[model samples]
Target: MKKGLRGLYYSRNEMDEMVAPLKFALVGKFSSGTPSIARIRARFAFWSSKDFSPSAESLVVPVWVSLLNLPVAFFHRKSIHNIACLLGSPLKIDEPTTDYTRPSFARVCVEVNHLDPLVNDIWLGDDDGDITQKVMYKNLPLYCPTCSHYGHVERNCLLKAPKNKNTPDVDSTSQEDLRIILDKKKSKLVEQPS
Candidate 1:
């Protein structure tokens, strides 16, 4: 009983929101695509992801890039050289910067954005039929400091906070986000940079 692509996508998106920071898994047509060492060495960056990990526990989801598998790129040595020349240099990615200017499987870097949820969804779908109900999680909102917003936290808060940004919001409803908002675990979760 393979869950359709859309169904799988929704389910995985739900799960990823739970485990922020690490353990992002990809499930799709090429979920097991060859590891492009070149891209790995290029040092790609991942932008902010809304739901990209597992919940209540540390996760290890694969950051897989959807590839076209260009035979010419690998078969023709000249093609590789020529493309490299046009590429200019390997792109450097950061929190806000992703390797998109001229991304290459040869570059060793791939971008993981929460915006593209279908691919990860498909990948997860192929793994198991009954996985849907087991991994679903709710969307986590960012917290605000000025008006006490719901989606952003203090460190990156767009507002001014009288207290440290990491301070738990007393208003978080039933502990289901991340720690204070609505964490699925309904328990205190330790925050660490992943």
Candidate 2:
């Protein structure tokens, strides 16, 4: 359920600690309508024992790959081996042979990044040893089967009330004040062409 939030607080507390420094940068003063910062949190849910586990093993995950075009026996063992060596050790290959009747794609399993979770784009080489065909990779993140959302599990969904519900409301006025301040600052900015 949605509810209104408080605008201002005169008391010296956590809010003051966070917002006190930005008084001049914001507006002359913060009032009851001033908005507060907000953050979105996510949770994980487990389905079956066979599902991927974050702590069980390596960080690698399976990624579906497909050749764009200009296919010249790139799915062969030698080519696959060369491609694997260029990238890294392939956890698994979809099929030893390429299905010309289909779209010509391959599924490879690689470790998930432990530091950066984002998967970067890939460039594959053609039979002429020149980088030509761009392979596409696709992977799904861990999500709850109940709500089917990217983050958070069914047990702790926002739709259902929890044991402790104290989501603080952000003041809408502060956001407007911030926008005004930003506009003023932007107006003062002078552009210089090089």
Candidate 3:
């Protein structure tokens, strides 16, 4: 892990064995003035200090977002930062974007609440015309809102209540029965006045 964070000037301390499953806390000091380590890529997951809490408020993660079809005029550092602000707290811009080598998209690292519905696109323009800039998030973590936790979606949530045995499971319902139900709803809607 230390080798992975080569230039960041970080110190590692192994947690007590009682904590179990082997965990190490790495504290890094960045000379760049930003406290974010979002650029670090590793096989393991990196959690912030607040992620240990069970509260939904702690459901925040650093994500890499790509602003697609952005205007070349907005490629400047300040302009990119401003555009990234619409998504979340902008951490840092990717090196390629800083150098303007990759014109396809401007990649930025941002810290956003996982619970919030991510923005798909944003309108950007002045008086001349407006263009829809598509937003794409990379490797966004799966989160179970039901359990207010990360790693799994709501459908596979372990905390979800088990279905009643007496209640029929939708998956087990016959195709004919589903068709009849749909027909009934359509008939009822037809009977109603517009």
Evaluate residue 92 in candidate 2 and report its C-alpha lDDT on the 0 to 100 scale. 50
Error of 2 at 155 (Å): 18
Top candidate on TM-score is: 3
Per-residue lDDT of 1-194 in model 1, one digit per residue for the tens?
24643232224443343333224423223235676988775444432356754332112222322223322112122333322222222232221112122223222122222323323322123222333222111242343444444545667663563665755566663455445345533344445434
Candidate whose lDDT is highest: 3
lDDT by residue for model 3 (30-90), tens: 3476435654543124554543754453577789999886665556676677667778878
lDDT of 2 by residue, 1-194 (tens): 01221111122343344344444442232234533443111111212356656545433444554445524345444454445443444555554233323334544544344333333334443223334334455654554444445455557665564544333333544777767767776776755334
Q: In terms of lDDT, which candidate is stronger, 2 or 3?
A: 3
Residue-level lDDT for 132 in candidate 2: 36
**How far in Å is the alpha carbon of 15 misplaced in model 1?**
47
lDDT of each: 0.33, 0.42, 0.67
